[model samples]
Target: VELILIDESLHLQNGIEAILTMVEENPEILDDYHFVENIRQSIIDAVELELNYLKTKFGGTTIFGVSYGELERYMKYIADRRLIELGFNPQFGIDQNPLKFLQKEDVKKLTNFFEVTPTEYTNF
Candidate 1:
């Protein structure tokens, strides 16, 4: 039940490429693979690193709750500002507003969702 809230500005390609290079050089994996497989593996590794960083280092997942005015601030903080800026107010749906339900009780529910709920696949 882990949550991931990307600020929309995070640089993904560079991190993905870096991780792919590392994984490709490792001698323990299969000796041969296709370009698409490499790219897919790179994306998976990059996502895992990002999630682990948010969880272990920050002690929680990110929840982008910026107000309308503060949206620009987060947009600038991300690596691909141009792309993120183009997608301003990127609401997936009316019900997907995290800030709208940021009441204390709602926050407690969200936080507890991570603690009490078991993910479909738990490493432990």
Candidate 2:
């Protein structure tokens, strides 16, 4: 199983109804940093608990880790050390121009550059 460390900031969108959208879609986005951390911790606990139970039955030897420090804690607690750190290499600037969504794991986020069509008029 792949461990996904979802970045909360990645979800925010800069739009006229940003706050309203946040409230409707994910109220968690408005939560304070500490409160959000608590939620993440609980999620980590649940995954560890499930992994512990599964290990007893099948004894699999692999951990795709997104957080090494936290994963080490659970690994020690459960006494399993077959962790493999998932790598994230985000490319910026011109370095990312060559990459595409169809490409490999290491990605370069491309800046969207497009022309907007001239509108005849603006209406409310």
Candidate 3:
């Protein structure tokens, strides 16, 4: 299982779509009408639980975190902590880089200093 948290629901939908593309090509995972609606409801409920817990623990202060990673293991730790804080489980998957499909020099100019290609750099 993987838990993905985003500020906006649409962004979460997009990320889930992209992740499903890499994980067995199951269109069922991306269907909001068929699947996501129910899942989303549960996630929202869980998030509320987490928010209430945080409010009680921190006197209603906003929660924020920063993390960096170059590997799945480390990324998972960061992702897990954040998602668990939101009352969800973490799911592991590669980060998708839409830039890889680009033929333009935009990605090269931006990522020239790094040894890995745009797709590789986007993993983080």
Candidate 4:
């Protein structure tokens, strides 16, 4: 498998924000749903802990100390797509992908584990 390490703080925050936004937009969905209430509360508690840990350890940097240039842009792109899938407006307006720096040949090499076609990989 191709290993891809992501910044947990950023990813988690994106997820939390999406969930919170969904709840805000559809408050009625939680009115009689104890299961949804429990899940939402658990997410809030976990997100609070994660935010505190990230702030304590990373300070102002969301990616910790990793310096994968343009990776942040790619992440924002993906986050925006996720937000769209969640019925929320995209937060970032980035169009170009930083991972586009990877050549088609290199992407082909990763296809064995990535399970994406060369064209799909390049577009991604």
Best by TM-score: 4
**lDDT tens digits by residue: candidate 4, 79-116:** 55555554455666665555664323223432343554
| lDDT tens readout by residue for model 1, 17-122 | 5555765687444344564355444434644565455455434333464343333223223313222332223222222323343223223322234667744235
> Ten residues in a row with the worst lDDT in model 1?
1-10
Worst 10 residues of 3 by lDDT: 1-10
lDDT of 3: 0.41
How badly does each model clash, as a count of residue pairs? Answer: 2, 0, 3, 0
Pull out the clashing pairs in model 3: 2-90, 2-91, 3-91
- Put down candidate 2 lDDT per residue, 7-53, tens digits, no spaces: 21123123214545554688766456664454445445655786577
lDDT per residue as tens, model 3, 7-98:
23335446555645643466555544646445545554655565455546555343333112222233344344444543345544333422
TM-score of predicted structure 4:
0.33
Q: Output the better candidate (1/3) by TM-score.
A: 3
Question: lDDT of each prediction vs. the true structure?
Answer: 0.38, 0.35, 0.41, 0.51
- Stronger candidate by TM-score (2 vs 4): 4
Per-model TM against the reference: 0.26, 0.26, 0.28, 0.33
**Which candidate has the top score in lDDT?**
4
Model 4 C-alpha lDDT versus the unseen true structure: 0.51
RMSD of 1: 15.6
Question: Which ranges of candidate 3 are over 4 A from the true structure?
Answer: 1-19, 22-24, 28-34, 60-124
Report the backbone clash tally of model 4.
0
lDDT of 3 at 120: 26
Q: In model 2, what lDDT does residue 65 have?
A: 28
